[model samples]
Target: MTFEMILVIIVITLMLAGLFFEMARPDLLVFFTLFFFIMTDIVSTDEALVGFSNEGMLTVGLLFIVAGAFERSGLVERLVSSMLAKANTRQGAMFRLLVPISGFSDFLNNTPIVVTLTPIVRKWASENNISPFKFLLPLSYAAILGGTITLMGTSTNLVIHGLLLDFGEKGFNFFELAWVGVPITFIGLVYLIVVGHRFLPDHKSLIEKVREKNTKDYLSEIQPWNRQRFFSERCD
Candidate 1:
């Protein structure tokens, strides 16, 4: 094999080994791999750093900030409480969860959608005596399905658009992916509500199981604000 091929193999091997052994974070592993390639002249410094300045990467970063702000504003919380509080059955709950998530994810990044919804869904399930398993997998699936509904819905689509630009080809429009994505999302939702529930296990949450086994609470106090805040003085 050629020297470049051998180097590629070694880098890939090290990456996999680091992942399997839990030696470092995945992003750190990728950075190290890129650094190695640049140092060895397999990839130029410009090539190694170009992705940081890519429009797609910048868009993804902006989307993350917007998502964080939206989540913090309590709009999702209010929406969840107002809509989902009335769902009595598991099917109804699943429907409520899927519809809003699928809708929001079409406009926003799905990662933050899932992250914001996970604990809320868990708490809702626990309170309503519904199995978390019934809702958690559907939450992830709905986010993924929703992301396809718009061109800017997921980072993957933007990255592919960037790749197309790099290749001197025109990329997709905002609603380009909506045609197929809408139909798929509709079909997937129907399947999840009608047939998918049967396949999901009605398992209790870990906390519930632990509580049942031992009627003792393990409490740890944590203070969130360690640093002096400008907000407190402003409010005063």
Candidate 2:
């Protein structure tokens, strides 16, 4: 086994471990994975970098900007205000107004959905003394789940449908994604509601404690090595 291959294996292991442990956000590791492959000469320069030039990435970035524009226009504020005024509790709000809002995002860009609804959710999270993660996941899951219901719900579905046509298979209809996606989404959601979330990483950065530090402290749940708790001390 070559040293380069060994190094490649280590990088892949680290990336996967981070993802499985939720130590770092998935998007952050994507670049590192690419960089590792490039450094290991696993892919040529052009091949390694070509994905950024793809039209899909540009389209998503543009969509995020457009969504942010709509959010900044205060329409989101008005709508969120109305919903909050009517809902009596946080979970009730999620089930009632927020879940539908997330579903609406499936037909649109999730970036805009995230940007528009994040503030509303943060405020609600604060008012109800709930962690942001508790509701944010529900909000994200709803939007993503709704997207699988229709071909136009997400660009990825459109891309897959196009691929099917290129392969001489029938293309999808508006609701075709839900044929399989609905069941998978439902099962995953039930799992989250039942178990996965109970294990969610709690960084302990509550809404009022939020700062630039907290925002970027993605791995805060992992405590640093102190003398008292160190494996080094035990070994000594």
Candidate 3:
């Protein structure tokens, strides 16, 4: 191959190694990789900066901000808690959780939705004597399926839409993906509820272990300043 292509392969290999080994922050590694390409004249500064100016990237950033605000509003927590409260069985709980998660993901960015709901689902599973593993997979699957339903549901859709617009093509309609997404999401949810949950490991999270330990036996000791003081306080 050409010298430039060989150099690119080496640089990318090193970058992947650094990321896999966690030798530096991910953002720093990516930034430095781009900077290296610019310095080597593999890409012009304008070309390198063009991606940052892409509408898709800006939308993803804005979506993260909006998702953060919504998460902070405590609405998600309340909604999840209310849903879990109404379900007494594991299947019922999974049904309740997955349905809303998929619906929420249709309009919002699914990454934040998954991250925000993970701990809540874990806690609920622990309390109800169900494995967090059982609910966590369904949670992720639901979010992914939900994101497919709308153009704004995931970053990938927006990125593709932006690329299309950049190429002077008409971009996707908001619900253009719903035709396939809706059916796939329905089938995926059914699979998770009917069979997938059965195959998940019953792994207990560290938080659950700690909580159980605390509930069973928690010990504390306090020392008195003096025997006389201790006795006096007791007598008093």
Write model 2 residue lDDT over 1-236, tens digit each, in one string: 98878888888899999999999889899787987688868877899866666444555677778778877798777787677668775445555654565467556756567667878777766765667777677667766766676665666775666667657888877776678767766675565555655676544445556753566644447666697668677888
Across 126-194, the per-residue lDDT of candidate 1 in tens digits comes to 877678898888888898889998977888998898889888999989889999999999999888887
Give TM-scores for every candidate, taking all chains together and pairing residue i with residue i: 0.85, 0.61, 0.85
Give the runs in model 2 whose Cα sits over 4 Å from its true position: 1-5, 17-29, 53-55, 89-92, 128-134, 152-174, 180-236
Clashes per candidate (backbone, < 3 Å): 0, 0, 0
Lowest summed-lDDT stretch of 10 residues in model 3? 209-218
Candidate 1 accuracy as TM-score = 0.85
What count of clashes does model 3 give? Answer: 0
**1 or 3: which has the higher lDDT?**
3
lDDT (Cα, tens digit) per residue for candidate 3, span 1-236: 99999999999999999999999999999999999999999989999999987887888788788878877998878889999899978888899999989999998888878888887788777777777999998899999999999998888998999999999999999999999999999999999988999999988887777877876666999875798888999999
RMSD to truth, every model: 8.1, 11.0, 6.7
